[model samples]
Each structure stands twice: as structure tokens, then as C-alpha cells.
Target: MGKITGFMEFRRLSEQSSPVVERLKNYQEFMPRLNDQEASIQGSRCMDCGIPFCTTGCPVNNIIPDWNDLIYRNQWKSALDVLHSTNNFPEFTGRICPAPCEAACTLNINDDAVGIKSIEHAIIDKGWEEGWVKPQPARTKTGKRVAIVGSGPAGLACAQQLARIGHDVVVFEKNDRIGGLLRYGIPDFKLEKSHIDRRIDQMRAEGVEFLVGQDIGLHVPPQKLQDEFDAVVLAGGAEQPRDLPVPGRNLDGVHFAMDFLPQQNRVVAGDVLSEQIKATGKHVVVIGGGDTGSDCVGTSNRQGAISVTQFEVMSRPPEQENKSMVWPYWPMKLRTSSSHEEGCQRDWAVATKELIGKNGKVEKLRAVRVEWKDGKMHEIAGSEFEIKADLVLLAMGFVSPVQKILDAFSIEKDGRGNARAATDGAGYYQTSVGKIFAAGDMRRGQSLVVWAIREGRQAARAVDEYLMGSSSLPL
Candidate 1:
């Protein structure tokens, strides 16, 4: 520890965001970073605990204490090296990750935890500015070729790791550009596409070939991929959105969150929209109070919506957590995102009953208050109400990976419909079909980017060991 009393002397400090008014005008990242001296002070707040729960909390299992010490000592380059050793894309995680690590920090029991994510953000941004981050291609060739379907964080990490180990890695993406959800599903306000573009350039230089517009099970045949590559990795994400089947389910104004968010991202990227779903001059109601729903709220306000209301079926979470009960694990607490702050009317314990419309288009939403009892939800009596709404967005999370793709491969699926595969024992990540493996959302269901990257890297190691008798790649 640079200063043993740092945690007591200094409270946690993180990135400052752009003014809400200015940031809401454009779809650009707004988080301002701390200076080097400030970052070092935050790093020194790390307790250097005997058993670091932060590492365990992090999905990628980053060496938290080591990097914290490195940064506290002002060894910025070494901190980046240690960070990259485990995570292939710290920038993405630093920006978007929820930082379960902070919740699991030992200091969080009664005090503020170390600002690990902010420090990580500062370190990686500095690394890029200094040109310390560069592509390192393998020195020799393994001659084993691998094809990875989907170019999200998982597929990208897997391809990068395999390419670094002298293996031929090719990524197939169904979209016009790579980064799957990162490129499109996320708004440029949350994560700029430029970050994804720079990383794609680095991966290309390292010998990872990317083929866009290749939709397996639709445009690209599964058999063709099998025939072309020695092995295949299905990292395709869960794209099926969980739908709300209600009285006005087929209404003209109803749409999925993915369909709405991607359009704004495209417009921000300079793509012209002939005619689009505009919330301008209309009352917007968004269902499902998760991140996707929040994104929809932010987008609607930017589109000049008359007003925005977000509904959540579940009861409101506690503002503060019981640290003694949830220490070293994620807690149930209210999380208000930056988008929520821009301007939103949030309602919890509310359920949508129907959509009232005019001339086949939605005009209002009928909803009722809900109460949970005995693990089952009950609608409260006389609580029905109608609210003005011209646009309705279903922001409920995804249910599973597209069933068509799973059926095409003839791979068995778990109860949740995700590809049935384990991460341990013989043939880890291997599918029922020989020589085929699955990772990320395909195998584990929809999850965080960090978890997806971790699974992809581990699956790459598994595939490498399966191909060559032995392997040295880190999982």
C-alpha cells in the first residue's frame, strides 16, 4: 500500500460526467476522467486485503490488488500490462461494467470502496494515448483454423486470443459491422463506436479476419462453416427479446427496445434514416425497468418526446444494502443510471394491462398496481389507470439465443434454451456435435460483456488444447 492510511484519509472519488443538459443533446460519451495524481490516490485506497473479494467479484477475475498497488506506485505501464493479462478489452468493461467488484470490496462494509473502475478507465485511456497498447501477433503458425460466429465481446476476445497463439481465426458477423451489441445495441452516448473501431483495427492487424453480413442459419449455412474451418465456435448472442403478450400486443406503435436503440446509434454514426420510429411530440411509455428500458427513456427524451414514463413490475429495491448479509456478493439496491437522471418518470410495482389505441395505433396504456405475495404477483383492486402514450417500447430482457440457430446445429439446449455446454472437465465448451464449441450468450445466456469475454478466452484455450496435443494459452 502506497499509504497505509489512504482508505481512512481519502474517500472514494470517480469520474465526473458532462453537464446533463449538454450531454443529452448529442449521443456522445460524457464521463470525464480523473487525472493521474487523482487516480493514484484512489488506487491507494485499496486495502490490500488478505483475501481480495474484488478479484472474485470481477467476472474476468482481474488481479485487483496487484494492479491497485502498481497504479498506487505510479507504475502506469505495468498496471496496463497486468490489466491486459486478464482482460483483452478493459476499455469496454471500464465504461459499461456494473463493477460488482465495488460491491464486494472489503472496505464497503462501512466505508466507500476504492474507485477501481474509474482507475481502470484512466489507466487504459492513458495506455492508448501513450501508444503502449499495440497488436502482438504470434511468432509461429499452428496451422489450425477456427471460425467464430458472432463478433460481440465474446467472439472478439476468443478470436484475438487464438490469433495471438499462432492459430488462424476468422470471425463471422451477421451485421454490417462488428461488435454485435456493442456496435449497435448500445447507444453512442454510453459507448462510442470509435472505441469498437479502434479495437477492430488492432485485431485485424493481429491476423483476425472478420466477415460481416454472414448470418449463420439464415444467410450463411452451418454446413458451410463446418466444411471451411477445422473447428467452429458459436458465440452468437441471445437475440430473442422477451415479449409482452397483452391486449394491444399487435399495435402499430409497439416495438422492441433493440429496434429503437439501434436506430439512434445509426443516426449518430451518420447513417441516414428514411423514416424512423420517432418519439417526438408523443407521450412514450417503456416497459421493463432494466438497462434497456433506461436506454429507451434517454433516446425518447432526445427525440423530443412530449413526456417519458418507465414502468417496472417488481417492487422498488432498497436504497441501501445490508452489508453484513451481502458482503463479498452483489446486493439488491436501487440503481439509477445516467439516463434516468436526464429526465424520466419512474414507476415501480406497476403492470401493463392493455394498450388503448386509435385507428390501429397506440394512444394510451392501461396499467395496474401489482403486489407480490407468496412468490406470485397479484394485481391490486381499483388500481387500474390509463396514461397518454403514442409510442410503447418493450424493454424486457432477452429470453434465449435464437432457436433457429440452435436447431440448425442440432446442438442440445438446456432448459433455458441456451447451448448445453460446461466450462469444466473433458471437452470443456464442446458441443454435442463433435469439433463444435459454444461460449458467451450462446452457452451461458445473456450476460455482462466481461463474463462473455472471460468465457470466450477460456473456450479458446479449450479449443486450442483439443486441436494441438498441448497448449500454453491462458484461459
Candidate 2:
């Protein structure tokens, strides 16, 4: 620890966010990174705990205490190195990850946890500003070639790792641009696209080729990749959104969160759609209380929606968790995102019964209050209600990956329809079909970006071993 008593002396310092009034007018990142001194102070708050539970808590197992000590000692470059050693994209996680590491912090048992995410954001931003982050191209080239499907975090991570180890890597994206969900699913207000753009540039410099609008199963034959490349990695994320199949679901204004979100992202990226879904001057109802739903609320407000309301089928969580019982583990609790803070009417334990509409356009939503009893949900008597809703966005999360890609590869699938692959032991990450590997959401179902990166890195190592009969890359 840099300072033994630092945790007792310092309080957590959070990043500053732009005013809601000023930020709603545009789609741009509002949270500003902490200055050096502020970041150092936050870093110093890391306690001298015997074991850093934060590392185990993180999906990528980042060396939190080491970086915290480095930041406190004014070693910014070293901190960035340590950060990058584990996380391929700290900027993405620093901005959007829920920071379960902080929840598992020893100090958080009774006191505020260290602002690890803020410190990470500062380190990475500083690294870029000082030209510390640069291309790490392999000195020698291997004859082997690898094909990666999907340009999201997992695919990008896998490609970068394989390329750095001297293998020829080509990433194929179905969309016109790289970054699967990051490019279109997320709003710019939370994460700017420039971060992904810069990484793409770095990857290209590292000899990773990217081909857009190349759907492996649809446009391009899946057999071509298998024939050309030594191995194929499936990193495509789960895109099968869960649907609300109630009455009037076929209404025109009702759409999946993916359907509505990507259109706004494309528009922001200067793509003109023939017909775009907008929340302007309309009563918006976003179903499902998750990050996607919160994003809808933010996007709706930005589009000048008359009102924005969010619903959750489950009961509301406690404002605070019992740390004594759930220490060193992620706890279920109420989490209000920045979007929720901006403006939103949030309700829980409410289920939609039907969508009332006119002329094939959704007009209102009929729902009812329900309660959980004996592990089953029971509708409350006389609690039915109707609310004005011109647009309904279903953000209930994804169920599995698109089955067509799996079918094209003739790969075995798990019971949940995801590509069947293991994460440990021999032939790990290898699909039942030889020479094919699956990682991230394609293998593990829908998950966070950090988990995807972890799987991607590990999958890269697995592929390296398979190709060379051994590998030195980190697992």
C-alpha cells in the first residue's frame, strides 16, 4: 500500500457529470475524467487488505491494488501498463461497467470504496494524451491465419491477441462498421464512438484486417473462412432480444430496444434512414429495468419525448445491501444510472397485460401490479391500469445468439441455443466442430463487455495452443 492510513484519511471522489439541462440537447459523453490530483487521492483510498477481493470480483481479474499504488505514487505510465496488461479496453469498462470490483472492496464493508473505475479512466486517458498507448505489432510473422467473426469487444480482443502473437487475423463484421453492439446498441451519451475508432486504428496498425458488411453465414460462405484460415473464432454476441408477446404486440410504434437504439446510433453517425423511430413529443414506455431500458429513457429524453416511464416485472431491490452478509460479492440492490438521474418515472413489480392501440399504432399500455408469493408471481386484484404510451420499447435483454450463424458452421449448441464450448481443461473454447472456437456471448450467452474480453483473451490462448501445440499467451 502507498499509504497505510490513506483509506482512513481520504474519501471517495467521483467524476463530474455535465448538467442535465445542457447535456440533454446533444448525444455526447457527459462524465469528465478526474484530474491527476483527484485521481491520485482516489487511488490512495485503496486499503491494505491482505487479499484484494476486487481482482477476483472483476471479470478480467485486473491488478487493482498495484495500479492504485502506482497512481498514488504518480506513476501514471506504469499504472496504464498494469491496466492494459489485463483489460484490452479499460475505456469501455471504465465508462459503462457497473464496477462490481468496488462492491467487493474491503473498505466498502463499512466505508466508501476506492474510485477504481475513475482512476482507470484517468490512467487510460492520460496514456493516450501522452502517446504512451501505441501499436504493439509482432516482430515475426507466423504462417497461420485466423478468422474472427463479429467485431465487438470479444472479437476485437481475440484478433488483437492473435495478431500480436504473429498470426494473420481478419475480423468480419456483418454491420457496415466495426464494434457490434458498441457501435450501435449503446448511446453516445454514455460512451463516445471515438474510443472504438481509435482502437480500430491501433488494431489495424497491429496487422489485423477488418472487413465490414461481411456476414459469414449470409453474404459470405462459412466454408470459405474454414478453408482459408487455420482456425475460426466465433465472437459474435447474442442478438436475439426477448420479446413481449402480449396482445397488440404487432402495433407499429412498439419495437425492440435493439431496433430503436441502433437507428439512433446510425443517425448520430450521420447515416440517414428511410424511416426512423423517434420518441419526440410522444409518451414513451420502456419495459424492463436494465441498462438497455435506462438507455431508452436517456435516448427518449434527448429526442424530446413528452414523458418517459420504465417498468420492471421484478420487485424493486433495496436501496442498500447488507454488506455483512454479502461482503466480497456482488449484491442485488437498487442501481440508478445517470440516465435515470436525468429524468425517468420508474416502477417495479408491474407486468404489461396488453398494448392498446388505434389504426395499427400503439396508443397506450395496460398493465397490472403483481406480487411474488411462494416463488410465483400473483396478480394483485383490482390493480389493472392503463397509461398513455405512443411508443413502447422492449428492453428485456437477449435470450441467445442468432442461430443461423451456428447452423451455418454446423456447430453443436448448448441447451440455451448458444454455441457449446467449455472455458477450462483440454480443448477449452473449442466447438464440437474441429478448428472452430467460440467465445463471449456466442458461447456463454449474453454477458457484460468485461466478461466478453476475458473469454476472448482466453480463447485466443486456446487457439494459439491448438495451432502451435503450445502457447505462451496469458490465459
Candidate 3:
């Protein structure tokens, strides 16, 4: 427990961000970390309930209250230890995770929830500043070789755990860089690339070999990995972005969110793009109003777009949740991200009908206001309209992992096209092929970064158990 009555005394304090005008000028993280005293006070607000719903709500099952108590006592290093005990990358989750743990807090029933994510950000930042983060090389080697495809959070987490257990781990990434999505998929403003780079260095120091530009089942065949390594873990993400199959969809200025976002990320990382999709001075229309769509809005604003607009197919959610009914769970409420705060007109229950273009380029978009009734959505009478649009970025999430690689390995896929693998029991994560296993988006489809980390850790434990008769790694 932190302070006995602190929950009643303190209110939640979120991380502060720069003003819209200033932050939109460049693609950089604007949220400032809390000071030690402020973080301690926030931590003290923890009620330390008997059953921590935050732990269950969090995908990785973080030990929330203990770390909060540790921070309240000014035990920064101890707080870091407790955080690292469960989460392999608290730093990543600290920045990008949506913090479902906060929604599930008992205090959120009647009062503001404890600033768990803010405290985590402060703890991990302090750990790095104090040089507490370092490579933990295994004392002995188990001599089992593992081949991991993909360098995203899941693969990275799995590799780190296996390396600590003395496995000969080698990760293969298609991109020139180590981090798959973290390095490319996510925009740099939300998450800087240096974080991934430093972690890659730490893993390298821990004896994990990373081979970039080595795409498994492409440049190198899956059969080679089967022959060379004791086991293989597929952690590649679902890259097949859902397309908007409308008229003039093939026109110039129409692009995928992943395509546009990654180009800017590469540019931020000092790579000059050959076919960069820029929103500079263009009237940008973003499709799909999730994190990816929000990201497009942010990026377009940064790139000096004339105007930005977002569209969501679903009906608008309530500004605030009815906490009486949805307390201790993620509720259906309106979420306005920092990107949204910058400036953009947002519309709900509007569906894009067609991309109206001329001269082989998009010039406008045709859409219609829709009504939802009896579980079906239909267009409202005479609600069809058109809007000026120079660019359209589809952020409608991913459908499945790239089928080319899956087919190359002859891996069996579920109905949803994700790799078919169970998440429980003695031989979980094992694919149809005996030596091969799958985890993260490749197995479970698109999900939060925290869920990917959890799957990676669990898959690592499963792999460890499979390799050595049993595993002592945490579930």
C-alpha cells in the first residue's frame, strides 16, 4: 500500500504535452515526464485493493500496486525491478500502451484512477538515467539454437527471454533495421526510434544475433531455418492492410496508412525516400478513426497539410462513459488522442463511397451519412455528399500476415488467415510443423503492443519448456 488515505486526497495527474501549434511543427514526442516528487505523490494515490483488477486488465499482468508503493517510498530502483519483473519492455508500454490498467482500477469506480502509466514512465526513465538498464548475459549456455522471424515487440521480447536462458537466438528481419513495426509501422513522433536501437544493442550484448535484411521464406527459405536451428518462432506482424475497394481507389494520392507512416519514419531516421508520400499543402482525408488514422492526421499536420479530416464508419460514442455500468472495465467512450487535439475535423457514422479523381490523381471523395438500426447500417436519405480531397490515406487496420511468407513455410492458417496455434496447454504456440511455433500478430491477429509482448513472453516460456523437458520461466 502507498498512503492510507492518499487516494481520497490526490487526483490523477496526466503527462503534460506542448501546445498544438508548436508540437505540430515537427515530429517529436511532446509529453514531458513527471518529476520524482510528483510521481511519488501520484503513486501514493494507489488504493492497493485486495484484488488488483489493473493486473488482470493489463495484458502482461503488471504488478501495479507493489511498484506504486515502491515509488511512493522513494525506492526508484526497486520500482524498476518490480516493473521489469513482468514487462520485458516497460519503456515501450510506458509510451505507446493505451493503459487499460487505469480503466480497471478500483478507484476509477468513484474517483480518478491512479496514474499507473505516468509512474511507469517516470520509473523507466529514471532507470535509464541511472544506468540501471543493462544487458544480463546468462551465466551458462543451454546451447539450443532458435530462429525467430520478425523483429517487432513480440520477437524482441521472446529473444531477450530465451537469450537470458542461454539459448542461441538469431532473429531475422525483412527490413534493414531490427525493429519490424516499432521501427517502421509506428510514427516517430509517438515513439522515437532510438529506444528500439538501444534495446537492439542490449540484446546483441546479451548474445542474441540479429540478421537484418534477412527475410525468412523470401531471401532465405524456411527449410534452411528448419535445418539450421533447433526451433523457429514466427513473430512477424499482420501487414496486409485492408483496402478500400471503391472507384478510383488506384488513383495517385491514395495510399495505405502503413505506407505513408513508414515513409515519414524512415525520413525521420535520416533515410531519403525514393517514393515518399507527402501531405504538404494537400487536403488530406483519413479513413478509419483508430490509432492509425489518428497517426495519419498527426503526420499530415506535421508535413504542412492544408487541411485534415477523419472519417469513422461507426456511430459516435458518448463523450464520457456511464461508469456506474462499465466501471473496472474498458468502456465505450469517445477517445480524443493528442493528434486529434492538434486540429482536424472528425466525423462519425460516415462511410466513404468512392474516390473521385481526375487526371490520374485523387481530387475529391464521395461519402454518405449512414444510420444504424437493428444491427445494420444503411445510408440516410439524401445524405450523400462530396468533399475536396487531394490525398486519402486508408488506416483501416491490417487483415493478416503477408501470405507470401506463410505460403513459403507451408504454415497452416486459421479462418482469419492468422497462423493456427493454441495459446494454452503443454505445447502451446506449436504450429502444424513440429519445430516451428507462432506468436503475436502472426498467431493472434492485430492487437495492442502490450498483448504482443505478453504473447512473446508466454511463447518463449512454451518454447523453453519444449526445448528442455520443462521451463522455469514465468507464464
Candidate 4:
């Protein structure tokens, strides 16, 4: 509303990225945040729509229009405050979150949606640069100890909220580092680790303790946390990756995307592995067409792979969606990520038949073209083909959380193997086990990082109310 006709005057402007040839040489963030003027212009494009669908579209329900107006009015610090009021880590969401908010924007019905993500990216980056982001340690202690399992976005968000509310919070991570997936699963090219590191520092200053290499169910028994802490929150993500059960799946060259992705991230963090999976000089085939698969393609191209190919079982989506039919909602359409633009041979509606290999090492992949009818798949006759593939990465989405952790605590599980917990009513986020709660992927299955943050924040409020008999924390 800062400029009434600004939406009509300005067009959407996306952030620029480094050239493909130049960026392929290293694992670093390619896209730079919009400059102050560009961000302000982008913010001004926010139309004064009667109802802001962008907020409802976002999992965290970010105050979009307010911040956009603030940015347009040159109130950078206030914009940062509005952003942090809802999102615990806008930096993470700003960098990696697929912005559903943009798809649901009022302007997206006919014209390009406002560049909300870029404006958010600029706001948070500027907040850090200007020292507007700092520790907000609680003034009074509640004397209640909370144990948070998993140090990803969910656990971290929960810990920060509880800590800032005067509760003693301790985050336990199985990995040797603080960030769980953020430190390992994602490539540095998409989101550098320094952002996570700085946030960790701020959390530490806020009185949240982080204990790395501490496996809760394994090294530290589940009973210890329940006995020691007043409350326990399980924010561990879904780690059980879906597998292709075709013959030769156990071949040496075939690996889960998690296995391959984390190693590269660790290497980028200066850890030298004794035996690491590399795509160097090999024909790489990444199965699955989601973000994980795109990550594999980018990493493979950077690792000097002879060739990189990506396969999606589903048919290719249209390049553009029919806005009239799908307006104010996320639409199914083609999305080419920065990794895809780097270099990748992409094919859709192809299903892998089997892995063809020599000497227990995968050498090629045999697949078939298939057609879908009435929600059923039918293989096309004589459409089988084989392609050279020295490395095959299974990038299909994760199916469930590791069952062992749930079993260790005797927690009830849903039909999908996620911890059984409700989001509303009494016993919200509470597991069957007393004093135990579940949030994020552990409760809702694998989802976006923004959803994880939303779950974490809400779970914190639930726990707060359970402890103090009342909570002022935002839901």
C-alpha cells in the first residue's frame, strides 16, 4: 500500500545468478540477493489486495504485505523484525524454500508475482550486516529443562523459542556437527553452511545448549532425557529413503542420495573422507526428479562427471500452468532449478527396469517408457532401453523416519511410520509416551523446511502451555 499503483508500474524482477560456466567450477552459492534499490522496487510491487493469500500459502504464515510495505518505505530494520516474528530462520527459507507464497500471490493470477523471496533474502542479509540480528536472551529463568532431539530447522526453531521464553533447552544431534540436514543433505551451492553456523552462535548466546554426536536412542537412552528434562521434543526428520527394489539394486555403484550428498557437503566443510563416492569421470544417472535429484545433477556436473542424466517416473509437466484454474494455489508445472540449467539430460515418464552391471559394480541402467491412464501405469511395448551409468543415485523422496528411535521410546506410530500425533485439541503434539512430543517430519512425514519451522514453533507453544499452564507464545 506504500504506492497504490506500484504494481501496475513495476514488473517482477528476479535475482541474478553467476553464469553457468563460471559457477560450475566450485560449490558455492550462485545467486546473489537483490540490491537495496532492487529489493525496494520489488517490495513496492506488492498489490494492496483485500486478502493476502500469500500469508495463507506460506507454511509459517509470514507477514508478507507488512514487510513489503516496510521495505518500500525504506524501513529495513522494521522489515527484519516483521520477518523474524514468524520465521525463526528466514535465511534458510529464503535460500532453499520453494516459495508457495509466490504461486498464491494476487498478482500471479495474470502477471508475474511479486519477488517476495528476493525481498526476504535482502532483508535478512541486511539485518545481519547491520547488526540488527542479535541474541534475545530471556531475562528470567523458568527452571524447566527441555531436551530437543535433532538439530535441523525444526529442532533448532523449537529450541530457540523455548530458550527465549526462559526455559533451559538442550539440542541433541547424532551428527558431529550442529545442523542436521542443513549441514549435510544440502549442497553448498544452494545454501552455504556459514548461515547455519552464525545462527548456531546466536542460539548458543540465547542459552540453548547444543550437543553434537549424541545419538539419543543409541548412546543416550530415551529414558535419560525423559527423566532429566521436564519435556522432550522429537524433531528428527524422515531419513528412510524410498528404494528401487529392482534387481542389482545392491550393486556397488548404486547409492542413496543421502549417502552421496552428505559426503560432498562434509568434504566442502574440509573433512577428508577415506572412501567417498565421487562422480568424477563417470556416467551418472540420478533417479527421481525432485530437489534431491537436481542436487545430484549439480554435484555430479561439478565433480567432472562424463555425463549427467536425470529421470522422472511421472510425465513432464507443462512449462506454464493455467492460472485461471489454479490461481491462489500451488500449480503443477515444470520448474527448472539452477542445477538443471548447469547441465543435465532430463527425461520423464521413464521407469527403471533394472540395473545392469559388471563385477558387482553398476555399469548401465535398463528402463522403459510408460503411459499413465486412470491413475495406473502401463509399460509401452518394446520401449525398453539401456544407458551407460557408472554411478546411480536414488533421489526418490524419503518414506518415513527411522523406526528405531520411535521403537526405543515405545512411541506409537501412524500408518505411514511417522510418530502418531495430532496438531490440535488436547494432547497436541504429545506422543503416547508421557512427556514426549513429536514435530516436523517425525510427526508429519518428510516435508519442506518451512513446514518444519512452523511445526517446531507451534510445538514449542504447546509445550509451554503444558508446563506453565498458559502460554503467550505465538502459534
Error of 2 at 395 (Å): 0.3
- 1-475 per-residue lDDT for model 4 (tens digits): 9988999999889999999999999999989999899999999999999999999999999999999999999999999999999999999999999999999999999899999899999999999999999999999999999999999999999999999999999999999999888888889999999999999999999999999889977799989998999999999989999999999999999999999999999999999899999999999999999999999999999999999999999999999999999988899999999999999999999999999988899999999999999999999999999999999999999999999999999999999999999999997999998899999999999999999999999999999998999888999
Task: Name model 1 segments beyond 4 Å from true.
Answer: none
- After superposing all C-alphas onto the true structure, candidate 2 shows an RMSD in angstroms of 0.7
Give the range where candidate 1 is weakest over 10 consecutive residues by summed lDDT. Answer: 24-33
Displacement of the residue 142 alpha carbon in candidate 1, Å: 0.5
Q: List, residue by residue over 401-450, the lDDT tens digit for candidate 1.
A: 99888899899999999999999999999999988999999999989998
What is the Å distance of residue 370 in model 1 from its true position? 0.7
> For model 4, what is the C-alpha lDDT against the true structure?
0.95
* Model 4 bad stretches (over 4 Å): none
Query: How far in Å is the alpha carbon of 278 misplaced in model 2?
Result: 0.3
lDDT of 3 by residue, 383-471 (tens): 99999999999999999999887787888999999999999976899998898899999999998899999999999999999999888
What lDDT score belongs to each candidate, Candidate 1 first? 0.91, 0.95, 0.92, 0.95
**What are the models' TM-scores?**
0.99, 0.99, 0.99, 0.99
Sorted by lDDT (best first), the order is: 4, 2, 3, 1
In model 4, the clashing pairs are none
Give the alpha carbon lDDT tens digit for every residue of 239-350 in model 2: 9999999999999999999999999999999999999999999999999999999999999999999999999999999999999999889999999998998899999999
Q: Please list all clashing residue pairs in model 2, or write none if there are none.
A: none
Candidate 3: TM-score? 0.99
Error of 1 at 11 (Å): 1.0
Reference-based lDDT, residue 433, model 2: 93
Judged by lDDT against the true structure, how good is candidate 3? 0.92
Q: In model 2, which range of ten residues has the least summed lDDT?
A: 1-10
Cα lDDT, model 3, residue 214: 95
